[model samples]
Target: MKKINLIIATTLFSITFSIGAFAQTETKIGALIGYGTEIENIGIGANAEFPIMEKLTISPSFIYYLPKDESGIKINWFEVNANANYYFLDEENIDVYGIAGLNYSSIKVKYENSFGLGGDFSSSDGRIGLNLGAGANFNIGSSITPFAELKYVIIDGGQLVVAAGVKFNL
Candidate 1:
């Protein structure tokens, strides 16, 4: 009876400790900058990541492209995206991950002819699209992790996005 009691106590302790060690949730916020091919513009973005499972993370992000103007027409664009990332190689100091997401993009255009005979014109449009990307995170002992990613955005016209950012784990 004494031996059985000791074995059960030991097993319970081991299980409790193991669960405590691996059940931590990770949350991170980051600021990003990107360049896109279709628009030929620079974009600024921010994102937050939360762990859903041991190998999966969900990130919500927002990005805005700098306004561009040509021949009296000005265009502004922005996007909101939610991404699911799967980490295939999670190590002590590095993580390699693949991401897929859905994005909603909005564009506003304003036009005014250079001649005095023209009036103001404005239009807005929204598009729902998909994004696929791969990234690597390098942990440098601090709470900050630096990452770089390249993603393709499939919509009316395909766009390639390249970005880099630092994430703060909280």
Candidate 2:
């Protein structure tokens, strides 16, 4: 495991930076559709960005996964995230950034037996974890920017989330 991590670190350090997009620090509001790899379910989310300094921003978002039920069991999941975005490139119409933040994930499960011979159960658990990811924004126009992100939530069981959406400048 340590060797793999070192290899990854070395690879990242060896890559040369490329010029990409025009840098902007405007505030934006947006909505997203995301997929959780571990849950195998689709989710909807909303997020807003506030620039705190040049080339850096704080983005807060929330996502709610559509419930999934099988074999008399139902599961629901959601997450709230706060991340800092640091833009690393500035050349063309696309800006790439790295993100690191905190994640709060909640999962609820319920089981019910329709027959007269069994007991029903329900429980909910919430976890706090770390988030590491990368994202990009397409500066196609002035009023709106389209973006996509891939992030991994590090909790009891890590999950990768892929999301894409548009940000409305406000």
TM-score of each: 0.83, 0.84
Residue 118, candidate 2: Cα error in Å is 1.7
lDDT of candidate 1 at residue 67, scale 0 to 100: 98
Question: What local lDDT does model 1 show for residue 80?
Answer: 73
Q: Write the per-residue lDDT of candidate 2 for residues 1-170, one digit (tens) a residue.
A: 35434533543332211001112446777899999998899999888777777888878788989999989899998887878999998658999999999887888899998996779999988888999999999989588899999999999879999999999886
lDDT of 2: 0.82
Candidate 1 structure quality by residue, lDDT tens digits, 35-144: 98988999998876777688898777778899999888899987777788899998888899998998777888999866878688999877789999998899899989
The global C-alpha lDDT for each of the candidates, from Candidate 1 onward, is 0.81, 0.82
Best by lDDT: 2
Error of 1 at 114 (Å): 3.6
Best-matching candidate per TM-score:
2
Candidate 1 achieves a global lDDT of: 0.81
